[model samples]
Target: MKIAFYGSSLVSSYWNGAATYYRGLLRDLAARGHDVTFYEPDAFDRQQHRDIEPPDWARSVVYPATEEGLARVLAEARHADAVVKASGVGVFDTELLEGVIRNGASHAIRIFWDVDAAATLDEMRGQPDHPLRATLKQLDLVFTYGGGDPVVEAYRGFGARRCVPIYNALDPATHHPVAPEPRFSADLSFLGNRLPDREARVEEFFLRPAASLPDRSFLIGGNGWQWKELPANVRHLGHVGTAEHNAFNCTPLAVLNVARDSMADIGFSPATRVFEAAGAAACLITDAWEGIELFLKPDEEVLVARDGQDVAEHLRALTPARANEIGEAALARVLAEHTYTLRGAQVDAILAEEVGQMRSVA
Candidate 1:
């Protein structure tokens, strides 16, 4: 299969989370012998701030963000077996969708892969400014990064012919436990990009835990949180990337996960870090989110803590023997059910199903 992906950025993970998810999924697809041509805008300076590249497995087409460039690219869209458009790209998304929907109908399948489901829904509900609502009917298929329940209903409710959740997945080969390094050693670690909405959750679910465990060393590794004044007990390591992520996950006694407001409200949708941390065989303690148990069995594969006190309790409970067991179980569960390879297959199935339904109707 030949697939074309037009997303926020496939080349950079700098302030771009969707890129990380796409790289994992598409790279897996490429490994499966599918030809992938990832389209990225020349804007955002992604080439300079590249995180994960084409991986020598796929082709990358970086085009200008102007009208002329988009028009030229849309012309080539007809050659692809599947073409994907992701949310959060700072362009004229509605117009771009309209073009693909109308012109790319000859040979390509149009897919809208939404990384931000809640924010998209919220926008669609409010005003005409939401670019996707009108274009939803024209999209061949809809895939979400992580909304287990609400995502399906909401996308279909918005007139998506088909909707599927392509949740964040872990590749165990990339995220395995390693020898503890001094840089990553901490009693607990939380790694996430800083955002306004997520900050409060961090304070509630993360910082408070640090405050409670004065004796314990907590680490924070992510971009954008540096300006925010961290508590004395908490150590901020700024931004860490793919090479350093395993160290950050494995060295800590326990890793923390706090969902953004949208993800927390939507439920069941976990960030990429959850899978990464679990895959690293870290004793994982996530802030109570509705859908965690569906993936990681609370008290079994991992633990869930709501308040600072709960974090403290889990910190104490996770001894070497206990923590290792939890990490191993969580890793097993993620590899068994939550790899990007599985997600790619799921997407392929959905696309095939849609094609069959169309043929039957015709």
Candidate 2:
């Protein structure tokens, strides 16, 4: 299959989960013999901030990140077997969105691959910008990264023919645990880019706990957090790249998983970090999320902590040996159910079924 992905910047994946998701998925696709071309705007200073490059597996094309960029994408998309318009490209205009909607109908099965379903829906509900409503009504398929149930329902209610959840999965080779390093090794660590909505949760779940457990070294990694207050025992390591993520996860006695607003609320919608932590065989201490038991068995595969005190207890009571046991169990569970291999297979099956139905109609 020849697939063309029109998405936000893939060059700099520093604070971009969507790009990371695309990279992992496309790499898997390319490995399976599919020719994949990822298109991104040249804006966002992607050339200067690039964290990843084409790795013999797939091709990458950088456009202007403007309406003009979409024209180039559409021209290239004319040749693709399928074209995906992922949400959060951050450079969309009505001309581009509708061009794919109305004009590029022949070879392009324009898909709405939403990386952040909840956030995107929030945008759609309030402002009605980007001419997305019109584009969505014409979308061949809509794919969501998170938003377990409510998101799918919303998409359909909003007039999509099909809505499928393509949940995040761990690329095992990149995220597994490693030998300890003094610099990154800590009692507990949390890594995520800070956003305003999540800042309060971070304060409650991470900072307070670190303050209480002064003896335990707590570490935080990510960008957009320059303003956040930190306790004395907590270490702030800015923007951890994909390569450093494993070292960051493995070096910790336990890694913490913090979900953004919607995933926490919607339940069962685990982020890629959840699987990354598990793949590292790191026992996880996660904030209370709706459907956590579906991924890691509470108190067995992972420990849940809501308030500051709960986090302290987990840190105090969970010995390194116990942590190792929990980590192993979590890894086992995820390896059996949530690797990218499984996700790719699921994607293939879904696309095949959808394509078959389309062919029948044609």
Candidate 3:
């Protein structure tokens, strides 16, 4: 099957958190003998800050952020067996969503692949005129990064034909244990872009804990945090590249996972960083969210933190030996169960079944 994925930049993780998820899943899909082409807009300075070149596993098309550029890519993508319009493309998303369905091949499975389902669903509910609401039922299927039953049911209520949560998973080839880098070393570290939905939680889970333990070193990675006030002990490293993720995860005594406001409330939406950190066998301390056990068992495989206090206590009590033990446990669990190899197979089966059914009906 030929798959055309319209998403944020695939070669750049700069300001684009979905880059790793796209690479891991699409690479897996390509490995399964499917032709995969990724079409991303050259917006938000992403092309200028690409972390990796166009990969051999998948064809990458970086289009200009203009209507003409979008049209050219849409013309090329119309023939794919599966055409995916991912959420948060950051440029002409509405046009792309509607365009794919309008212009794609008659038998093509038009999919709305959402990296942030919780947030998207909230928008749909709050604004009846939301662009996706108009196309919700027209899409052949909706695939989410993660949101579990709540997201599934909500999309169904909104008249989606089918909705599946293709939860985030680790690509061991991309994210695994590496020799710790001195710059990322810290008692506790967090890497996430400072966004409105996530900043409050980051402050509560990461900054507060850093303040509570002034003597302990804290590291903050990811872009847009350079201006934010941080504790004297916390070192801010803006924009950690994808190639350095393993080292970033490995160097810290513990890595923190803070969910966005919507993701935590909706539950079951684990960010890609969770898997990346765990894949590196980093002792992960994550904020409380439902369905975490489905990915990594708390206490043994991961450390669950209810609030800033919990994070502080976990950091204070964590021994190097205990951290390594938990990290190893996480690594074992993800390698065995939560990996892109498994996720890609699952999606491949879903697409095959859906496409088969559509063709039969035709």
> How do the predictions measure up, each by TM-score?
0.94, 0.94, 0.99
Candidate 2 lDDT by residue in tens digits, 87-203? 766666455556556545474566778887887787778876546776777888898896777888989978888898988887887678788778898898999989876787888
TM-score of 1: 0.94
lDDT of each: 0.81, 0.79, 0.94
lDDT of 3 by residue, 1-362 (tens): 99989998899998899999999999999999999999999899999899999999999999989989999999986789889999999999999998899888888999999999999999998998999999988998999999999999999999899999999999999999999989888999999999999999999999999898889999999888998988899999999899999999999899999999999999999899999999999999999999999999999999999999999999999999999999999999999999999999999999989978987898
lDDT of 1 by residue, 119-214 (tens): 788778887656687788878888888788688998888888878888998876677888889988888899988988798988977788788878
Clashes of 3: 0
Clashes of 1: 0
- Inter-residue clash pairs, candidate 2: 177-280
> Which of the numbered candidates is closest to the native, going by highest lDDT?
3
